[model samples]
Target: MTQYIGRFAPSPSGPLHFGSLMAALGSYFQAKSQQGQWLVRVEDLDPPREQLGAADSILRTLENYQLHWDGNVVYQSHRHDLYQTQIEQWLSSGEAYYCQCTRKQIKAMGGFYNGHCKPLNHQDPAGCAVRLHIDQPVTEFTDLKHGQITLPQALAEEDFIIKRRDGLYAYNLAVVLDDIDQGVTEVVRGADLIEPTGRQMSLYHQLKQPTVSYLHLPLALDENGNKLSKQNHAPAIDELDTQATLLRAMDCLGFAIEPSLKDGTIEEIIQWGVQHWSISQLPESTEITPRFSNGSV
Candidate 1:
């Protein structure tokens, strides 16, 4: 049987919160339940949004919860050369091209990039972003939890940027390449990223790599039904109360643990969680308001 390899990648924009913990624990349990390898990747691609010590803080927080990864942590910031090589290959082969269109221009056109610069064939690549020519867009894929997902034709056909004008690699390009490079067989992340799945799957086909199985866990929301995120000022999980945090995360993921385990150690809670983890139990909706005892993470 082929070994299952899953990953929990988080951006270092802030420390791990209850929402982030749900993704982490869900992925970890999913990987461990099958006796597969679980990996961690710090997506520190956008330096401007990354906090100075958030990366290390995330790692320490993971350790505190005993959600240890199988191998060395992969940092996207250190993999620019790899992304650059792929970008060059695509550009030389005409699979991708330079685009000078700004965000404002795209927004004016009903928010879909119309591939205006594809035929430009401009010699000057300076100050331009690299966009993949979506000759054959991916319109559908099956999610492990949500089943078949169909993407809009316009969204799939848009010539999405693979590299930004600021010279930073795009998330879609980097994530697809990284997953392929790491031999990842499954992707377990938040439903907030479900919209980009088709684009990433398209990139997988472009790279001639098989797309991996995906399971987008329901997003955790606050009382106002807003998704918990660093941008939304979600409180960071307290590593000091690792057990409580893990239990709370497990509950949010739809795992039923005994009340007796509330005071249990991290190991005890995790063991129960992994043994009982079931994607079937996850809520069908894309977002869920998580109930926390302390009112916050």
Candidate 2:
């Protein structure tokens, strides 16, 4: 049997919150349950949004919770050359083209790119963003938790940007390339990214790379049904109370913890969690209210 490999890639825009913990614990438990390798990748692609010390703080938070990874953490910022190499290959092969359309122009065209720049054959790649001319559309993929997911045909056919005009690699391009390069067999992340699955799968086909399995866990939402994220000002997890935080995160994942394990160490809790981890047992809803200690709910 082929060994399983999973990863948890998080942006270092802010400190780790309950939602982030849920994704970390979910991916960690899923990988460890199968005795597979679990790796962490710091997705610091967009430097403008990254906090001063959020990357180090996130690593420290993971360590405090005993969610140790299998290898040294991978950072996307140091991988511009790798991404650029693939971009150049696609451009040379006519698989991708340069785009000069601004966001405001696309919004004016009913919020979807109309492939305005595909016919231009723009040669100046310095200021223009690169877009993949998607000939084959990825309509559907079976998610482990959500089963068959069919994306809108228009969305599947739209030419998406691979590199931004700001000279930064787009998330879709970088993530797909990284996953392929890292040999990741399975991707376990939050359901908020479900919409991007089809695009990434399409990229896999375009690059002639095998698509990885996907299992998007339910998102942690606040009282107003907003996702718990740095943009929403979600409080960071308290490392000092790792035990409680872990238990709460497990509970959010629909794991029924025994009262006896209330006082267990992080290791003990993780061992128990791996033993009982079940993707099929996860909540069916995509959004779930996370129970926090500060009575924020």
Each candidate's number of clashing pairs is: 0, 0
Could you tell me every candidate's TM-score relative to the true structure?
A: 0.98, 0.97
TM-score of 2: 0.97
lDDT of each: 0.91, 0.91
Model 1 C-alpha lDDT per residue in residues 79-183, reported as the tens digit of each score: 999999999998899889999998899999899999999899866889999999988899999999989999898999998999999999999999999999999
Worst 10 residues of 2 by lDDT: 288-297
Q: What clash pairs does model 1 have?
A: none
How big is the positional error of residue 267 in model 2, measured in Å on the Cα after superposition?
A: 1.0
Window of ten residues with lowest summed lDDT in model 1: 239-248
Given candidate 1, what's the lDDT at residue 188? 97
- Put down candidate 2 lDDT per residue, 1-297, tens digits, no spaces: 878889999999999999999999999999999999999999999989999999999999888888999988999998999999999999999989999998899999998999999988999988899999999999999999899998998899999999999998999999989988888999999998999999999999998998999999999998888899999999888777788878988998999889988989898998899999999779999889877777652
